[model samples]
Target: MPSVDPAASSMYTNQAYNTTRTTDATSMDKNGFLRMLTAQMSNQDPTSGQDPNQYFQTISMMTEVEQMTNVATSQTAQLSRQKDTNAQAMLGHQVSYITQDPTTGASSTATGTVASVQFDDTKGPSLTMADGKTLVDPDSVTSIQ
Candidate 1:
């Protein structure tokens, strides 16, 4: 009977499976997860194969996360659209809102008619008064007439 050494086996002498870190440590995207799964599959031991059920479960989880992320994004976009619509509807109406002095750093309340609405991605909706000098934040509005 001939003895076969495990260390000299051809199955264990392949290259190491190294997956590069493309994303931050806290979170991994779907593409990163797929790349990692591929690497793992390619390097797994042949004799004792990985469970098919485990692979299916991991894929399912990834799919669920992707769907949830899409849903959240859609909800955010819908909310933004609704806000824009609401801000536009305030046109030709008088609104009372808090105002602050830039130099004196003093806060006061002011009333103005909504002349126009500006949609800013970073600032959201800003209402330009009839005077066109004052810019009012939609959130700062206290009363509408």
Candidate 2:
């Protein structure tokens, strides 16, 4: 009986998986670029140093990344504050909301005045019913009076 070699089969599979593959560029933040620059400086050949233009280009990229990060952070905080203001207006208003139990697949609707609002990093804003039940989905409000 003839035997199949495991090493030969593995080589064939690897070649099939890697065939015709083109490398895609991965995104790097400012910190990653800085680390890369540090490594490049430390490893450069003493006879011929790295180009000054490349160093300046890396600094420019880092500055742009920092500015973009600051803008994104400011915009996020502004949106959060707007949501909180809107939710605050719901307090003391009679509202109806729907809730579903995940395990039982049962649903129910409750009516009450909004007792308070809850805030977290992830959710937009949660509403606490007068009965103490909290609703996370703001759109689930069926009626607001």
Candidate 3:
């Protein structure tokens, strides 16, 4: 059996194995935590086992990550509401947008007064034209008169 250096073993870090970095490098999500934990378990020195303190710290960190994700999700929902409110204020104001035909995949410009705004978590904010039937994306608006 090969001998292991105790100090080197204790000093092992996730950085050594994490060869790639993504746009969200500043964050360690739940999945990231799990991957790191799995790696640690797989690579640990079998004779010494894991430090109990480190295990507890990992659990604490996971809780912190869960809280952070909740807060971020809440903030996003709040911002979406704000955007919907702003879109609602545009009701009765003239707006123009590009329309696409589902069958032909052709685009055309249409102009009408904003009649209503719909807030959807999946679709964000959408506008209903004064025509009472035409639906448009706020982002599709080319001009506001």
Measured by TM-score, the strongest candidate is 1
Which digits, one per residue and each the tens of the lDDT, describe model 3 over residues 33-113? 789889989999999978899899979978887898678767766676666666877899998789999999999998999
Q: Which residue pairs clash within candidate 3? A: none
**In model 2, which runs have C-alpha deviations exceeding 4 angstroms?**
1-29, 101-110, 121-124, 134-136
- lDDT (Cα, tens digit) per residue for candidate 1, span 48-89: 988999989999999999999778767776777677778888
For model 1, give the 10-residue run with minimal summed lDDT.
10-19
Evaluation by lDDT, superior candidate among 1 and 3: 1
Clashing pairs in 1: none
lDDT of 2 at 139: 65
- Return the clash pairs for model 2, or none: none
For TM-score, candidate 1 versus 3, the one ahead is 1
Identify the candidate with maximal lDDT. 1
Per-model TM-score versus the true fold: 0.78, 0.60, 0.57
- Badly placed stretches (over 4 Å) of model 3 are 1-52, 120-122
> Cα deviation in Å at residue 54, candidate 1?
1.1
Candidate 3 TM-score versus the reference: 0.57
